[model samples]
Target: MYSDDIAIRVNNLSKCYHIYERPQDRLKQSLYPRFQQLMGRQPSTYFREFWALRDVSFEIKKGETVGIIGRNGSGKSTLLQIICGTLTPTGGTVDTRGRIAALLELGSGFNPEFTGRENVYMNGSILGLSREEMDARFDDIAAFADIGEFIDQPVKTYSSGMYVRLAFAVAVAVEPQIMVVDEALSVGDIRFQNKCLRRLDEIKASGCSILFVSHSSTMIESFCDSVVWLEQGEIRDSGRPNEVVRRYVDYMAHGVNDSGNKSVFDIGIETEQSSNGWEWIRITDQNNVRALDDYAFKRIRVKVGEEPNASRLPCEPTVIEIECEFLALKPIEFPLFAVGIFNELNEPVIHCNSNNLGTRMIPIVDGQLVTCHFKATIPGLRPGKYLLAIGMDEGLLGAHQLLCHVYDAWVFQVLSPRSGRIQGGYVQVQDATINLQIMKGDRQ
Candidate 1:
């Protein structure tokens, strides 16, 4: 028996379909199997099996909102259908503790021939609501739908937006304990989407569990407490929203048939380092010289510990140095030197520059090399590979002219101990303290 706190439990869930090459092949297979068995001959199969989902397992606690993210044909809809009881699973089981209201596809449950009002009543009845209960909630549902005169019109004449509006309205009107929404809000306008989100927030406040699917990463990050990423037909990753989303973005941008020869960022230094301590790792050398109209990056270097080629430990401090040379023969004015660190997903984690720190570059003589250095310890960086980016600009923060910007100028990795506190996130908290104080009046 499931505990009271568990809303949904799915174990070894799978779905499969049979594909036949021709219509006659399906008919022959259906008949030949039975006839061959009677004739004491072995039966032959003419169809191929396609597994839409395989051994997918996860659980949702009560009042928790979980987001589902995946590309098309990733079995997201198939899994939702099985949970909503619209489709049967070919293997495994899903145990749901409460009534489920789902808006899977546009115009799925509504009858095209029936009016909007009729469909609402039919859907409510399907959710186990009596006629009197539907009558009591009819006005609220209509107002929430806001399709004014179309309430009396046939649903077949409704637009996609109108269909989603009515379907979402009916789903929420049933007051289900579990709500499943699948990219339906993408069709509506921003204002309508905000209204729907507000209503969902109210429902969630009443202890309803939500399972949402959307392509908007911002929405998932803002609304979901946890996330599940699906790839091909299985769960690729599941955890905090920010971590999973970043990995998913990286996979989509870099991992698709990527040959080792063509990388977005190239490492200039050799892979192996000398055994000498505190060796200088050159990220950009003279061979990587690409000149802009104003200036160009001459070289980039980082000083590390004994194992200069290996991933740096989080406890170690490193120094990054960059050199830029003027391309034009004229004097440059107000030049800015900048450096940034980005994850593999191209999300910027840190950005620092000389201008922001109130340090201005001295007037550069023609063809003179200018150097800038940064030294710091990144305390809580989790174990992963990161990229360094460098750029030179002309003006202030908002109105800067880009002289030259190089992404992935250098690649580095962070190595953390297994028992470290920075286990699964992008940033680490170096020092954290908690204290409790008692009030005199409430003291026990």
Candidate 2:
């Protein structure tokens, strides 16, 4: 039930998209009236109608934070667009209170021709802020953005990071009653992301309703007060943030990794406590152990959300990608890396890009994000606490070199599952494939 203090109410809102047979049908529909009079309402040339959203409804309290999640193409973006007044709903309506500020994309409202100062003022006006009002908040905005002297420089000349800093600063400064944030927050460095998160928390404390959409479940769990899940344009679950995200992660891991069959639904994730939360070991390599003197490749450690790794994997990876909360020594080039898996003797298990998989040719820039995938087809490694080696290796042909370890990383256990199925396996790679046929009807 939506209490009297509700700030937004969405009732049976839906959006439909028509798939056209030919590209020209769009133009025809726009001008169909001129020639369709003789035909008395010609049937739509497009043969398909896809409902991007179906019978979706939710209510937000005055200062509640809501998270929206679904697989790609599940209408998450469309719903946000409708709420932000960027797109119209095919059915139903969204009722909201007060002015709204949206950061659907970084620099969406920027004019490349203008300096950051001018764009800030112009975007502020568009968001309903007056000159005097913006001027009063300008100092706070600039200090929060911390983009140096670039605020007076043309937006076109700003780096991607600088642009994001400025755009986000302005949006938060305008002080709208409702604010919508998309995944663009993933682009910035860790420090900036943390700053933004703190500001968002401050805004929430100030009684502003916020809507957030991100692929990372950890981010959702740590941030949103409540969560809503959408599947194939329909609402699947709406309630606690912890419950919904666990389901989404389960849905993503099914078939690719392990799935708990006891649940009625496919995408439900079961939670349990852990020591610092390092359960599944992802990186592996037994060879190329770094001696204390090996300094060919500089070591680059990882920090969550920026630096080398994120706190959570964007998707339910076949292998468990551990959280990185620390970094190593001084900065190197652009592609520092950490690899983990099983090692022989003391060798690292996996590489920056495994050469055997033809991925070794790719150079890993220092602190760049690289996801190393593995096939868990061969199981039965002796169970114990195994260490996943984090290090730098020079790939084949020196195409790109992995300098060194950002951190020593952590360890995980391989235990036995009850059903004779291997337990603690990181991936769900098919164990075997079998085919049977009746030979010349003899069996029959």
Candidate 3:
């Protein structure tokens, strides 16, 4: 959780529950008697205190991909509930910057009396979407749900697949800025699961921030930007998806895992807050469309600082939308410097660094600082955590830096885009214009 680039800023966030042996003891805590405190007694009750999330704080910038990784009871669900506003934190503030949709629990927000069509509109509205928006994507949702005429049937009669299909259709169709999915895919059919993954790619493409929770380290390592490994309601490590997953996989594989809670990377959130604004980009070399095997490091920059919602990044958005005041920190680097991504294994992944791609070579006026974005398409990583590395190619010799003991910045897991004919790559050369001409030879 980044305290700086705060999408959902959790300031000292904590959730606590009071345990009681007897049901009557619970009645006392909610409605304590004067006798409980006046006797100078420690409430002489067989009750315990359990903290789901203890003093946790971090910021998520818009469009940043994040993964929440932990064992069961590590407070992953509790933390997500707080973020999704389903459960109130015992202490601290959670500020959500934009529309949010959470696949936290199956059927978390469903009305048994409502039909699939009606529920889509209802659920979309509840998730901060307007009726008009839901109406626009009505057919799209139905097609994805694949419930056929069940769209008119009451949800009370829905099979688990039908229920999830309807719920998921509505969740992703709402165009959420922050989407939190918690093992929602595990329940669906493999075909539906793959469909949801495809939709996820579209959502990310549309600049939605996401926080995902899953027992599958493969998912976290392959798809999330950075993962938070929690243990017993506290964060142990947060960084690249693959590195954290590797540690997690190793722990599970070797059965030496004793933390029974958080992940291996105890690296806390560094980096300050970042603005969220975006302009779509396609990566390329100066020559032309890029091939999959090519690694041509091309230089490009985008004129920035022209969009709204510059502050407060959503949880899983890939395109960052944030505001900037343009401080003249000549050669200004950030809290975590450049943000990049990798696969699940501990190998060198791709990254974007000002230090590596020298953009300030030409002299500038004393205080002329303008906002610009540097985007590069990172190819060749096989869907897990390649050890994340950062460097500054400052007109010098090989100075590759695996910053921090764990270099835990830029955590992203790849979700294959749904577009069937066109697959993975930076550019879209498949699109074209078709023109028909009259027959030159006057053939019949």
Candidate 4:
């Protein structure tokens, strides 16, 4: 049993399956164990043991949203199935504090032979809701699902998208204290996915614990309070969403151990200094190719405000200047220079371009040493490491030829402010002024 504050507690949980090399081996595995037991001999396994999960332990506190991420066959689905009580673990214990609504598989809880209306009530009953309660919520569920007349049709006739829509509708309509989702939202259309995300945010705001599984690191980092990285059925890392997701991404990209060297994108921390006290770091040596045209980025450097060595803080005044030098393989007319800053999750937080600033640029000839300069007052980004990207293109916004774009061209850090602090959000707006107005009530 778990404490009241713990929504779901899984202790030393594990699940294993028998892997047979041939079809007949499954039959052998099933009968040989019983026969050996009856013959007063030890039962022998005809199949190999595949542990989908091994000694996995974690707790989801009530009202906390936790995300699970891993590559395919890493036991992410198996772990969620066990936690949702659809699959029993081979070892360890699972405890729950409240009603759980899960959308693990498409149409998992629905009866394919039954109508969508019938399945809705059936699912509600399984979740311990009375028929009367379901009846009152039926209209709302149907509206949310937007299945139209298909609600009266058999579930077997429904498309994959329709099935998920109705299932998500029923799951959220039940007002569960805990929600378990396993990438089912990816089935629906973009509009539906956004709608479900908004509803999920509402559910989290209502004090319901959520366990979400997705391959999207940005979603996990932005949405979940904490993250768990599962690798080969074991907990590889578990902690804050940003740190764990970063490591998971690094592992995925490099396919190396976490104890390995810094990631390819992380090489910008090492800077080279000149005798004149100017330091420049390499973001990446890769060249961006577009339309069979290749432009080589020779160098890119950043200067923070007036001081090249000044430290930027959250909610502070800062001007960012980016200088890029590239070799144009072909002639380009009026090339556009752009700079982008991304967070640890690689999501762009701020972007500026020469066109946006209404700047005029000169043309580039073949084998030209193209130098681009960008100057802007950068926003008050969160206190963390930020990646800088530089891109050079030609032509209009919608129709343009990308000559070269260097991602992670440079990396910078924003320090915490000594006077104040900006916590919990990505960007903090500078200069705050509060105004209060009170009106007096009059009586007749």
Note the clash tally of each candidate.
0, 27, 57, 1
Q: Using TM-score, give the best candidate's number.
A: 4
Clashing pairs in 4: 283-409
Model 2 lDDT at residue 231: 85
- Per-residue alpha-carbon lDDT of candidate 1 for residues 280-374, written as tens digits (9 for 90 to 100): 44434312223355566644556544333344545334444443333434455777777788865557778888888788677666666666566
* Best of the two (1, 3) by lDDT: 1
Q: Any runs in candidate 2 off by more than 4 Å, and if so which?
A: 1-3, 31-37, 41-44, 256-444
The C-alpha local distance difference test score for the whole of candidate 2 amounts to 0.64
Model 1 misplacement above 4 A: 256-444
Scored by CA lDDT, what does every candidate get?
A: 0.76, 0.64, 0.60, 0.81
Full-model lDDT, candidate 1: 0.76
| TM-scores of the candidates in the order shown | 0.64, 0.57, 0.57, 0.71
Q: For model 3, how does the per-residue alpha-carbon lDDT over 1-444 read when each residue is reduced to its tens digit? A: 445445677788899998888998877766565577787765555479999999887667777778887778999999999898889889988888788987878767888998877888888777666778777899999998898999999999888888888888878877788888888887888888888888888888788888888887766766778888887898876766765666665455433333323332333222333354332222221111111121112221222124332222222223432122222323323312343443445433445545456644343233444433444433322322222322222222244322211133223333433443433333233335789997678667
Clashing pairs in 1: none
- The runs of at least 3 residues in candidate 3 whose Cα sits more than 4 Å from the true structure, single-residue gaps closed, are 1-5, 30-32, 36-46, 256-444
lDDT of 1 at 195: 92
C-alpha positional error of residue 352 in candidate 2 after TM-score superposition, expressed in Å: 20
Between prediction 3 and prediction 4, which has the larger lDDT? 4
